[model samples]
Target chain A: MTDVRVIEIKKSVFADNNEDAARLRSELKGRGTYLLNLMSSPGSGKTTTLIQLINRIKDKIKVAVMEADIDSDVDAIKIKDATGIESIQLHTGGMCHLDAEMTRQGLDNVSLDGTDLVILENVGNLVCPAEFDTGAVRNAMILSVPEGHDKPLKYPLMFSVCDLVIVNKIDVMPYFDFDLDKCSEYVHMRNPKARIIPICAKTGEGVDAVADWLLEEVYNWKH
Target chain B: MHELGIVFYIIRDVKQAAQENGVEHVNAVVMNIGEVSTIVPEYLTDCWRWAADKEEMLKGCELKINIIPAVTTCGDCGREYETVKYGKTCPHCNSANTWLLKGNEVEIKEIEV
Candidate 1:
């Protein structure tokens, strides 16, 4: 009979990834690159918001975009066509989230020589993506008006982890019965320090605030 | 939802541990999954079965889970309560300043060889 030897290895599954994320953050800091990990559900207008926000801030800052999806280059091509900036597509090969290692690999494909900021459009998943840190300087998420205000209470982890929350498609708020005040309150309940910005990407309303926020973050990262 | 991805992480860690210990095969991998850690044990084990069998060292390796009950501590009244029942708010003082003390773990507790 073979004896079973138990070996204690008490470590969180995310421990190694957290360490990698930290290392990647410091590396990006040294190179004067600010990475923003943007997460949301599918059809949350993440791409549209990015296009609006990117066009607003492109001239002010040297920017790049990395679009990560299960499979497709549509977002990558869209960003490039709209903003004419360096945008790359990263296929997760069926994975629902991007970890630090995957983010590093995507960054390798990007030209970071003079890039000030790299916006990573993460897979449109509110659940899995929140569990993995992608070595970004800050984390942000978009919650469209149609998704309801209760998302924060449901996906607490996602809301808690993000530094900023953008409430998109606010132009249709009147038709959808989406309460901006209640959404703010719920978001604050999940994350006290999270900054909430309401925007209508289609009309370019409230997008300047997001662009200004990014510019300020990039400036802070530099000096 | 991402149990398969987590299974891959577990495999990577277990393989590393096995390599470090000079073990030929791992008999089982014990995990401490918190009640609120958001991982479904059934899905994790199911994914493990599919992914582990592909690895020579972890073939037929059992994945055992130890559920850790989620607890929350209220800052306003200094009371502890079950996280799953009450969530972020404190039941005693009805304070919203409560924080999770434990039960968010998704840890590899040990490996049996």
Candidate 2:
């Protein structure tokens, strides 16, 4: 006789990831470490902006960058060459996204002792990265002006989950049809509490504002 | 793109659940996917077909996805509306003080043995 049964299990597929993220958050809180998950599209200038932000705030805070990619140490190399701060490269082994577990492992590999801020430059993809919480204190994303202003409607979830949205490459705003006001409106429509800043990473414009916000957030998290 | 990884996770969870319940084989697994989630259902199933077939317990098993509608609630006016339609602002009240009530879930809802 064959046995057949239907079991009703209401478990979140993200349950394990969420639990891991929560635990990571708690541990970081106890250690007074602020982790920021940075996400964006492939050509969003995340790396450049990160370098600028590090230059602005490295003097005030102990910062480390975890550069994640499908396969590359180029970002880690670049950050080390530019800022000389501790940087680690994470290869996802062909995975398009990094989850909480992976992020925790990366945290372990890096020397985070006495580290005030750990910035995870997540694999450049607006989709998969936003779906997983990497136990960061907050989530931020970079939206380059070349990516067009119609992104919010198409990728609402990414915009919805972010705490900060930086519009990069603003120096070329006159060249592109990217309307700052319209883009801000769209982002606000998706996330009312999200802070939107316009900047050009190439010229180092508005990078201080981003650093200021990061410092404030780190302070708030610690205190 | 990461659907294969998600499929692996689903298999791991299902296998664990089956072991806990002392089930011999899992016939199908059901997932609650949110409307705004990054997962694409078709790709998920496609990946499942490729990966699940390799596991003895999940061979020929079906993967079912239940999409949950994204909804947001207006704090000022206390009105609920479709998130995809109205986004952050409430269409009825035009309030920026709004939040997503549901629809960002990726969960295993059921297991058939």
Give the top-scoring candidate (lDDT).
1
Candidate 2 per-residue C-alpha lDDT over B18-113 given as tens digits, one digit per residue, 9 for 90 to 100? 999998789989899998767788999999999999999999999989999999999999999998887777999888888889987878998988
Please provide, for model 1 over A1-223, each residue's C-alpha lDDT reduced to its tens digit, 9 standing for 90 to 100.
7888999999899999999999999999999999999999999999999999999998988999999999989999999999999999999999999999999999999999989999999999999999999999999999999999889999999999999999999988888889888899989988999999999999999999999999999999999
Residues B11-112, candidate 1, lDDT per residue (tens digit)? 999999999999999999999999999999999999999999999999999999999999999999998999999999898999999899999999999999
What value does the lDDT take at residue A32 in candidate 1? 99
Q: Candidate 2 lDDT, tens digit per residue, A1-223? A: 6665878778877788889999999999999999999999999999999999999999999999999999979999999899999999999998888999999999999887889999999999988888789999999999999998878877887998899999999988888888988998888878878999999999999998999999999999999
Model 2: DockQ vs. true structure? 0.69
Position B35, candidate 1: lDDT: 98
RMSD of each: 0.7, 2.3
Q: Which ten residues in a row have the lowest lDDT in candidate 1 chain A?
A: A171-180
**Highest DockQ scorer:** 1
How does chain B score by TM in each prediction? 0.99, 0.94
